[model samples]
Target: MNIDEDTSAWLGCPTPLEMYKHQCAMLEDELTTAYQLLKKARANIAGLVQMNDLLATEKAAAESQLRSVSADLSRVHVQGSEMSKQIMSLKIIASQNEHLHIENQRLLLELSVLRGPRS
Candidate 1:
């Protein structure tokens, strides 16, 4: 019958201020949820950074140990080659000594035959 009642009846009885309050409350809830998600993401990022640092340190140590072992292996290989050369040299010397002893024994037999009448 009146203008206010007619407007309220047509607009379902909710005013502009009540609608604003309801929208504000929904925005606050969304903001709170967003803040919580941001905090968890930050914590996860920090943990990942710490893990990356630890892995880097371990990788450096492993590389260092690999280099050291490679150097030692190279030194052992050189020593083995030198030992093989020494063994060959000793074998040649022993063969020469055996040949010389045989020649001395033949020469001594010839001397004894030439001095046949010796008492």
Candidate 2:
């Protein structure tokens, strides 16, 4: 409780100079520990920064890919629409061909009868 320069200086056992040396050594040890902890903390911070940057970059890439996929889907839809139109046109043509075929068959039968029966 009474910390006078004379009473607490030498700690009542060691010389003043030895006490000073001991105090200096203890302070040096504490400073070294603090410095090491600061260095480790700094390294951790740097690693976290790098990780954050990588995540941001990956997010951007994913967004770009999503845009590209959306565009491709639009193109596919257009192509499908065109194919449907072509199929419809072909179906109409097939119907016309079928009608012509039936008419031709009727005409051929009539011609055979007009020419008379074969021996």
Candidate 3:
């Protein structure tokens, strides 16, 4: 149909040209909002990546420190075990010394008895 007949058919309706322009403006506004959202999302993603990298570095350092501490604890345990062995040895030697001293005292008494009464 002719433009006038089509226009006349829809009484009080917006012209096709006006409707298209309105839809285009709405679409442009939506696109602008979407672009802004995308920029914000990208910035957030970048910040998250940097934080993740920092956390990973910190975790590695903590693990290294833990390993060092574990090694130190193992060394301390070994030293403690050695010290315990040495203490046991010392105890045994002290017991032997006590036994020898008693035996020597008994022998001295026997020697005096064998000599009889002194003038």
Q: Please tell me which predicted candidate would have the highest lDDT against the true structure.
A: 3
Q: Candidate 2 regions off by >4 Å?
A: 1-42
lDDT of 3 by residue, 19-109 (tens): 9999999999999999999999999999999999999999999999999999999999999999999999999999999999999999999
lDDT value, residue 107 of candidate 2:
93
Ordered from best to worst lDDT, the candidate numbers read: 3, 2, 1
Each model's TM-score, in the order given? Answer: 0.59, 0.55, 0.63
Better of 1 and 3 by TM-score: 3
| Model 3, CA-based lDDT | 0.95
Better of 1 and 2 by TM-score: 1
Task: Assess each prediction's global lDDT (C-alpha) against the native.
Answer: 0.93, 0.94, 0.95
Tens digit of lDDT per residue, candidate 1, span 57-102?
Answer: 9999999999999999999999999999999999999999899999
What's the distance in Å from true for residue 24, model 1?
Answer: 1.4
Give each prediction's root-mean-square deviation over alpha carbons. Answer: 6.2, 6.9, 5.4
